[model samples]
Target: MKFLATCPKGLEPLLVDELTALGAEEVKQTASGAEFSGSLESAYAACLWSRLANRVLMPVTEAVVETAEQLYAAVQEVDWSEHLDQSGSLSVNFTGSTKSINHTHFASLKVKDAIVDQFRDRFNCRPSVDRDQPDLRVHAHIYRGRLVVSIDLSGESLHRRDYRTESGAAPIKENLAAALLYRAQWPKCATEYPSVLDPMCGSGTILIEAALMKADVAPGLLRSEHGFERWKQHDAQLWQTLLDNAQQRREAGLASLEPVFFGSDIDTKVLNMARANAERAGLSAFITFERRDVKDMAPPNEAGGLLVTNPPYGERLGESSALMFLYRGIGDALKSRFGGWRAAIFTGNPDLCQAVGLKTDRVYKLKNGPIDSQLFLYTLYRKSAEQLAQAEESESQELSEQAQMFANRLKKNLKAMRKWVKQNDIDCYRLYDADIPEFAVAVDLYGDWVHVQEYAPPKSVDKVRAFDRIKDVMAAIPEVLEVPLSRVVLKQRKRQTGTNQYEKQGAKGKFFEVGEAGCRLRVNLHDYLDTGVFLDHRPVRRMIQQEAAGKDFLNLFCYTATASVHAAVGGAKTTTSVDMSATYLQWAMKNMAANGFSDKHQHFIQSDCLVWLKKQRKPQFDLIFMDPPTFSNSKRMQDVLDVQRDHVELIRLAMRLLRPEGKLIFSNNYRRFKMDYEALAMFDVTEISAQTIDPDFKRNTRIHSAFEVRWP
Candidate 1:
């Protein structure tokens, strides 16, 4: 007979392996489940021994079902007498749908009517509908107009091992915990390490599952009932024999099992619940539950073991900052206390995994309910106290030759810009822009904090050497800049395509204020690739302030609306900011409000600049500042934007909105940009790229290209 074993979506391969090990034949993988041919005894063994399956089903019949009548007729063709008696109770679980049969509940009603009508005609009576504790549970599935019905052999998804009566918030399902352990190779680790630990164990699901596997206890034995128990075809004698064998094996396995298990949680109430769960599972003696934080976690015994945990993944905004410290503490505790051990961490937020600071040996992708998650495995080596001290001392020692060269260059640039910085009262400026070819990075000073962006090296560069150079730069920055290591934020800068640059890097939601040209702007160093304020555009903002007085101003592609804020502070009559990103527009409003420009005249519009500009038919602005990205294929835009190819059209549209004699300041950061002089022969255009470069950015004259477009 053909049997179908249903499990979580990502565990189909594991389930196939499990069913084959249980004496199944012709095992095949399917979406969210697996299929195989097996005997009645093999099915029974799978229910008792398989730890990953949610439900084991036996197919009864299949047919082409397009309408409700066909579905009813197909279900009625099955031999009702062989499956259930007239006096028994039954339930039908319907899934999937077709074009003609769109409602699952209506389809289930038709199937139920067919089954009862057949029984009533044959014996003058019908089985009653019992959703709970039914003698027979029929499952109907429709896919692409084909319907296949089956009998649910193992009733309530096997994840409910029946041992967890109390659970905490967002507890992991029992079978998923088993799958994580399998991915971590916990069974192999148990033999070599002779121990297991969960630092954030809630309700002891992982711990109890580990104990059941180690003690050779059948997961099905703990259940009070099964779907096959009340069926007409149940074999009492064969099932009793299997149960007897499982009992004997359980006793023998428990006797020989010697590995210890430990679980801890910060909540006292959850720890109590975990202990109660272990006691109910009959493994309280083998496992220990304690109330403790992850920072204080230590090994239970002298023998190092496997440390597995499902730490909280910050699902909410602003929660990642705290979780970063939590993950770091977990890494620190593992390195200091649980040396010579293997570790596994399961989390939904993969980006936060970098905070752990350990190199992962293996990674497995799985799903926790609807959230896509990952399981990272690592091997931790023992570090003595003396070795840790020596490492710390070495980190603080003298810089290498290349590092000293980078430091001396930074010092020279700072010395050159000291007069300019003081005369302008600047609190943020570019300190370096890849001045040295070997050390390719951009360093900017935002008040006292430093932001360093390491540009991606070319393919010809050795990756290891480039990585070492990055390390040297990081060490040299704090020492040469006279700042604490904690205040220096480092980021990797890659060539962005499409809208990749706008995607968030972290959920810290940490924003700080920095003054520039007499304007206070909010900037976040950790959460985004670019801080809220663009330091390279300081000269442009200053020019806008100088030229704006009682004039209607327009800022296009106004990221964070910093330019708009400068215009409003410069006494512009009204300011309008436009961008596609709602996040940046909101930030722009905050910047305007911080500068006391929250009046109705200060408008922040969220729209694609191209689409918004094309819709305007009147020229209303006196001064317009348009700074667009060099390339963008954002889905929100109606068309792709390549400044070189589209600049002529963009300029025409902005000029249409420009009043007579008004100026349009246009700029882009594409170094290879060329002017389409013939296309814009109707308007007077002059290149102002040289005038826009400040003393701080004189080293890289091509940092940006600027133009002043005006009507003749």
Candidate 2:
């Protein structure tokens, strides 16, 4: 039988892992679901034992349909009277995606009409649609241009693990909650390591799942009916044998599992709710619950245990700013209170994650209902430096295996981060601050070049920790370049509202490598993010250097005029740098002045770049460097601009300033941007994305793209 298991956006891998373990064959992954071929017994096992699955659906038919008329015809063509009884009550559920037929309700109605009308035409009777508890629940998924109909294997969401009656605000679903633990390589922590604990165990979903899992209790055992029980194909004897086999398997697991479970929550009423839920699931004997704040937490006599918690995100719980404080307390408690144990935390907000100082080992993307959430995995065990060195030195090791056990703890958190970065189109943004103990490397990949700067966190978690991280991030570039300390100038960045003013400037003291083997360069230090030149533009700068021979160069919005300096160094006859900041122009002058250039060769214009470009009526330059701020509306400048909206016009205006066959090099950090190829049809545009972004920004390209445009 072909089955579909729908999952959250980021957890397809975990769900696939779960199904594969449960003996489901031909299991394949999907964006929001998994498709697999399995027997009825396999389906039952998935519901009974598998975790991380949202819904198990049995496929009834696969068809292609173009319109509502075609949808009814395809659904009716499936021989409705074969499996469904004419007298049996049933329900039709339709999920429509991008296709000619889009309305789910209307599509469902058409399917229902086809089934009932087909039955009326043949058997002289029709099954009525049951919206409540139906004998058979039909699910029609319209993806692209095809429709696949399936029957719900479980009556409700399998996450209703039947273990907890106690409900709290923002409680995780049962299956997803359990899947979190089972998918984690905690088994290597060994089965008998210690107790399972939840620091923020509101209503005890995690605790209950932990308890049932340890006891080897079938999640299905707690439920009276499964949707399969009503199916015409449901074999009573086969189901009985499957249950008998499952019970026997549980017996083996039960003998190995020790009764070690703990749960803590701030609310007294929630603890009571957890207890009630535990009792309903026959799990009261296996689980322990306490009313205690997460800040002052300790793992009971169980040493080297597991601590799982779901902290409040302001989005669902309305906790407000105090949540940050709460997160910091969580970090402190994890580091100080529970050093020997593992900790996994789930939260919707990443900023709050900054407060929890523990190094997340793995992060996973999990859904807590409709809201996107992260499950961060942090290993409690700390190996000595010697051990870390040995691990790193081992050449035969696979990165995945070593990180696998550690990864789950942080996988969910990483998934959360990945989604955020993808959404904001900032895949190149910083993932972790060095102040985080679990964090060591300031890793930013631009295109292909990966820029990694390693550092240790300060003992104190105050302003100095974050402040020191900024210094470390700034110090990284020069260290990678092997530049001297004398050549670098450190510029102090002012408090800009949009940018993180607290973070130190990127440019530091300049370094001149006497005979550097790779990319011999002069770098500038001081002021804002422009370090003599942007490292992200290594390739673009190189392109300018190549095209600079005998050309007149235009650098617009050119802070520090590094590109102009490069153009001059590349043998350009005349190079002009236009910017609103005179200080940057002077700094640009110093860069050129150091390279032995004077006012006679290089021109500096301190004017609004946009306005200056508008005033230039005649084309003069053979090359132009155009890199704009993502979005800005300055009081000093007359116009407000955004990269997403103004890119075309900016390119249009910039090209007018370029002489015939002159190149206009444009760059922006918005990753998901689509350039208006239609509007810019007058010029030839080629993407130099891979070339422009250095290794430091490669984790996500489209983090920035470099485009070259010239008249045909």
Candidate 3:
């Protein structure tokens, strides 16, 4: 019998190899699958052992046709009894359409009609149709004018491993995960029982696949139903023998297989899903699922292992910049923690691979669903301090003259800012702000740490050169600041939506305490892009503290509540902080606690500032600090806010809760803000933007705009 094993595109070679190993003879590869001559045992074994094959089909008949009638006649001529009984249920999966039949469903209906009529004419009875679990699954592939019919031996796509009762976002297909393991040379590793880890193991697909491979268990053994089980030519005795053999092998494999699988993910919900998947697969004992960040993922055991993961590719717009930083963190973790392990990263974007910083030993192109991706195999190793120093010195020597000039400028800025920062007793301040047009990065120092925010270079810049320049800047920052490389954190800044701004970029959970104006606040440089505090708002916060003495102060849109901390420290009678983020509110509470202002007088409210202000009629504030986002369409808010269009109403609502002699200080980071002087003619409004600009922000005049409004 001629059998065809179908699989995903680009995996035909792997399928052919898999079939050949499983005793399928005369194997010939095709674009979508492989064709081979195999007996009943060969077909059954292919269904059981072939991990890459989506379906194993036995060709029933074929005919050349130019019209739908001819196609129906071709299917009707086939001996359906050889595949399905008259009283059995049947399903037809049609692929392709010709000029005569423009739709696949119509073609499928024609084929089904022909089968029903043939059965009715032969025995006055026809089989019933069962789409979900049919006794016989007929696969009809129509080319330009030819129809090829086959009996699908595998009812469902083999990728549905029955273990995945739940899935995470963008989970990989199990077959594809198997293919990744095959390409990672896991078959060889399985013999030695080497450890395996997927740092971003969403739903534990890869870990489960690895464990299945190590156990030498047929992936289909767990399925209770298969298309071949109900077919007329199923050969029950042969299948029973195969099942018995599989069970025995599985038992022996389990006995010999030592647990070596480990997986980690930052999302706890997905970790639960991973655990459930492992438990359902009977692989719970072999794998350990932990809720860990990629940056903190080290080898689970002392034994050297293989690290394989499918990291996020930033397919969404405005996400690539953030993912680039994440890729860098993954690379850093690999270098620092898992030195002896082999690592494989499957990603669609090549730019993200460049950020990994490791030299790729091998790269293989494969399709991830519809996107073309590359699987980069790397040998991760830790470099000695001497070797790293030598490499940095070599990179420094190769830096371009332009990059060298930028480095010199950074040195000059740091030299000049040292005195100013010391005189003002500022522990955190901006050291460089895009001093050069070609090198667009902001460098800020927070005590012993440094945060470098890279501005997305324009399309006109050569990406390779831009990357090199950024590396040069990173290299120079640590040298100039006299800090270790690990103390320097790099982030890419792009136009971010209000909703995404609050999202955590990493899961380092590492925070450091920094001092600003007699206030000690915790700042996280790794987990978020903004470091929990905006350095540019130093002057604005200081102004709020000075003007908030002996008054009921209100801080609206209080991100991290730095302004609220200032007001409370300045001896405000009562202070209320309002924000939409619970995380920021927690951070605000921490900041307040750090400043010894965690009493009832210092309040943090989690609510939409607009809604909270509208509800405030009796509890009036003596001084209000309102700093709204430039634009917000956050789903948490009842209404979208555009500061340019809604500033008037926002200020109006804030003033309603203001006492008669109260002051309202409104500020925003919109660079091109133009206040509506005509709309606010009722109050004495003074623009203090120039005064709010600190010495560190002297290069950028429009860092932020502040206003003081009061009814005189």
Candidate 4:
């Protein structure tokens, strides 16, 4: 059959590549889609594995339709009875480009009328319009005054994936989320020592998708019905072969994938939905589901892992104040507890990034519907005081002179930027916050994200001054952004780790609140130079109130335990918080008690959370959450904790006490964490980070990441 596989815009190449790999013939690209010809098997293969397409459209006819009357006449010329029976249900969908026909709905209506009229005249009985559950779905499009008609080979949208049993507000499209993971290079996460996580794992779409990818499970296996199933030309034997092939693939995938899926959300309903979805997909023993607030995410064990999440950006769903609140919390959690780990956060709102605290290394442009989105890759680094001092002492005096020279030059460049802002409409804009090449330092007044560039020492003061000029040029960049000066924050860089103390200097960065969503996180940005919030985990935090009631919450690492605060708000009965930092533990306790958790039901332990786990006499916990730092050398604990180095061991420790069917949620921020497949063979891992991100930091990676431990 000759087919055109339609996909989202700018994804034609991906479809073409897939068709070529499937051994199809004459694969060609189109502006809005792609075309290919192949045997039935090639078509089936495309349906099973193509990740970037929307539907498999099999063209039935092509005609020139000049006007509405001609369009109706051409449609009536086709034999509609060949596809749909007299009593069969049918629906019409249309798309049009720059031509006389502009409205999609009108085109669809005309095509539907033509088909129905034909069936009535030819078969003496017309097929009824059943848009909701059409047995035969015909699609029409008008491009360059030419109409192409085809049968919808896919019934439900491929993104429906059938893995989600339930959903939270603002859920991510499953396939789209999976595509994002593929773009991020997913195999590395599965192989890393650290587990992948979605701290905000809303409905668990990304988590389930990641799990399927890791396991190499066929996505079509979960689909109960497809468009071709009801078509008159449907072949039973061929479909069976496809099904058998898919099954074989699953078996092979199972043999290959060491299932390790972890999902966390504040909403109990979302967790329950995730649990149900996993079971439906036959992943009952492949994933663990939990109700956890992102703020209080503690490692179920001491091992660090990868954190891949989708935080919130208010542009799509809510107000700006609410978005800001969540962003603040996200920044706090990564700085306080997820250090040494890496994270990828996706968001659409660039304005509220002040919350994630950590500097971004790479930012990729993406799109969700019409809204422009971005993916930020953060390599969360934790350098000890000794390391900082050593670096400071290692630099030569000449280097210091060059660094000073760079600063001076930057001041000079700002002169031009100031002029541009005055001329432009931008009032609140970014003057100089991060991403200056010559300076190797940047600060945004509202600027919290840092992009550092590597550079060499200058030959002279003039050369050094040129480096500063680059920064000045950057300061003027706000004018291009159209944001105002008040909105643009500029200052010397203040980061957790850098080249040296002399190179970077600043007082405490500004401490801001989360959002206007009726939540307050008591976090300090000074002691650790990070605001007390995990912006990436905002969605998961919002999810708690819906699911946390009457549940017992376990938080490990519990740095400031902001997630604990969310769990308490969600009405958890007994919350146990553990951490090695006495000061942070104190804050966690304070956050809990402030949110109505009393000494009776809420408890805080100031000790090595993993070490204390050895004495675990607790039978089973309803919800288990672990968000450990990527690396930490605590005063109380002798050994250093590296998230990527010890995740499997930590997960095993947490599992020892998990009750039957209980959920264990773990997350970390090791950007390039490689899971130890040998160690995680006994359990299942799922990545649910995409759904976890909320509105404030929607463009940023929500959590470092999350994994669910599901077992048979």
List lDDT for all candidates, in order. Answer: 0.88, 0.69, 0.86, 0.65
Worst 10 residues of 4 by lDDT: 495-504
Candidate 2: tens digits of C-alpha lDDT, residues 289-332? 88887877876874568877778776411132235557876776
Candidate with top lDDT is: 1
Lowest lDDT sum, 10 consecutive residues, model 3, at: 315-324
Q: For candidate 2, what's the RMSD? A: 17.8
Ranking by lDDT: 1, 3, 2, 4
What lDDT is reached at residue 23 by model 2? 95
* lDDT digits (tens) for residues 347-366 of candidate 4: 88764564565678777666
Give the per-residue lDDT digits (tens) of candidate 1, residues 419-476. 9899999999999999999998899999889988888677786645665687678779
Candidate 3 wrongly placed segments (more than 4 Å): 1-6, 16-42, 55-157, 160-174, 181-234, 243-345, 354-364, 369-371, 376-407, 615-619
Q: Write the per-residue lDDT of candidate 3 for residues 101-133, one digit (tens) a residue.
A: 888899899889999889999999999999998
Instruction: Count clashing residue pairs in model 4.
Output: 117
In model 3, the Cα lDDT at residue 29 comes to 99
Model 2 lowest lDDT segment of ten = 512-521
Instruction: Flag regions of model 4 displaced more than 4 Å.
Output: 10-16, 25-32, 97-105, 298-305, 316-325, 328-342, 354-361, 380-712
Residue 392 in model 3: lDDT: 55
